[model samples]
Target: MTLTQRQARMLADMTTPTPTQHAIQVRGLTKSFKDVEVLRGVDLDVPPGSIYALLGSNGAGKTTTIRILATLLRPDGGTAVVNGHDVTTQAHDVRASISLTGQFAAVDEILTGRENLTLVARLRHLPNPGAIADDMLARFSLTDAGNRRAGTYSGGMRRRLDIAMSLVGNPPIVFLDEPTTGLDPQARLEVWAAVRELAARGTTVLLTTQHLDEAEQLADRIAILHEGRILVDGTLAELKQLLPAATVEYVEKQPTLEDVFLTLVGAPTGAPTPTPAKETR
Candidate 1:
């Protein structure tokens, strides 16, 4: 069947990543605090319009790496670039092209959800801060509660609003450090969908997470960081290949405790969880 020009263009856009452009590129990136070393030497390459997850345990320098990439912390050694702007020399330019969502939601407690986003918009000098705030509220399913103070918002709503505020400047790269922490499973899925929508719209996401399933769900590529260094980097399949082959081939399926728990809780088996269908404004 022949497709029309519009359909062809849509397909091309969906399938093709922005070539010759990398949202984040790092080489021998190093950082240290006091007498202790945090990041010995780190390297990463995140292409434009893809989700690259950094998986690590605590004190693995994941946050340190993200901070450096977002231009929040200067590295002790090496170089990194975000949106082609050097994190070392062009820190301001790199900051301009990126947004950072840290482990905790950064919202003003006394301000309404709308106000919180509005404040961010104003700070960024975005045109029509009120309109942008309302748009973010609607996009995150918070229009009904936008008038209420952020302190009154649920954890999920606050998290959503935090992410919405990060998008006020329409940055090309976003750094999400444990975005789903402390959320109910459903809320986690919502944020996951939002992250996907960002990538689909040509935004590059660099996420740090401890949740293995999350990495499987949202990341196109993943790197495991340990002791401030990347232990492995590859697609999920490639990582699996590196693991020892399973000797026991199960001809019959057996439900495990996790399956039973999920069944009891009504969790879907790797299905796409429903998310806010509102168009991003």
Candidate 2:
């Protein structure tokens, strides 16, 4: 899609949603594009103000499910209620309650970061466009680069700005369709921090990612989607309990490449891993 089209769609998500007890509820949701069935029977229950990850491989209907909930596309069968409104019958109400960030950042190359934000605020007919833009820029740690054109931003910075733009109106729930796709490790970490902050502020996040580590890092609850079906849904520990306990064994653990890279680059590390390289060398 062209840049204008993408911006228009993002602006359309700025409507305010009514209060609801549950963030999202779906049952037997199905969709098909011509002969191919994308979603067979999907059931989900997302609690308020939590991060829910939909883990699936490519062509696993993650995006299709998100689109249906966001009211961008119609489902062929079953029901989806987002923020207390049925996705089909109450499409406008559903749209009012959520925002979406697609696989790629949909920012205008020519516009400055601040301009891009203020534009969305103005489109939504908000009260203070400048203040809203400034607040988002600061919230996403883009205050220093707010005046710079978005084309010059790094991958991580662009994604942060994209997410900030999606939050201008404070929609109750956000749909992130592979928000970290194509980002470098550092960039991905930056986006992860931003997502965590969103959940901390009582906003519900429905994240779709193929990266297992990403899901483990961000999601409070995870649902594995495969072949248009939900194989399992639970917390990480609950899912791990499904497997038999490991037999006792003594084995040396090694620092993974990620650890070495993060340490060498001075990026943040969640946990410390042994650095045998220093002693061996």
Give the number of the best model, judged by lDDT.
Answer: 2
For residues 1-281, what per-residue lDDT tens digits would candidate 1 score against the true structure?
Answer: 56667655544443333456677878888888998799988878788899999999889999999988887889999989889889889888988898999999999989999889889998998899999999888877789999999998878778888999998878989999999999977567668877887888888999999999999999998889999887667677766655456786435445555455445566533335333224332
Clash pairs, candidate 2, are none
TM-score of each: 0.82, 0.88
How do the residues 67-107 of candidate 2 rate in per-residue lDDT, one tens digit apiece? 99999899999999999999999999988899999999999
lDDT against true structure, model 1: 0.82
Worst 10 residues of 2 by lDDT: 9-18
Candidate 2: stretches off by over 4 Å = 1-20, 268-281
TM-score of 1: 0.82
Cα lDDT computed for each candidate against the true fold: 0.82, 0.88
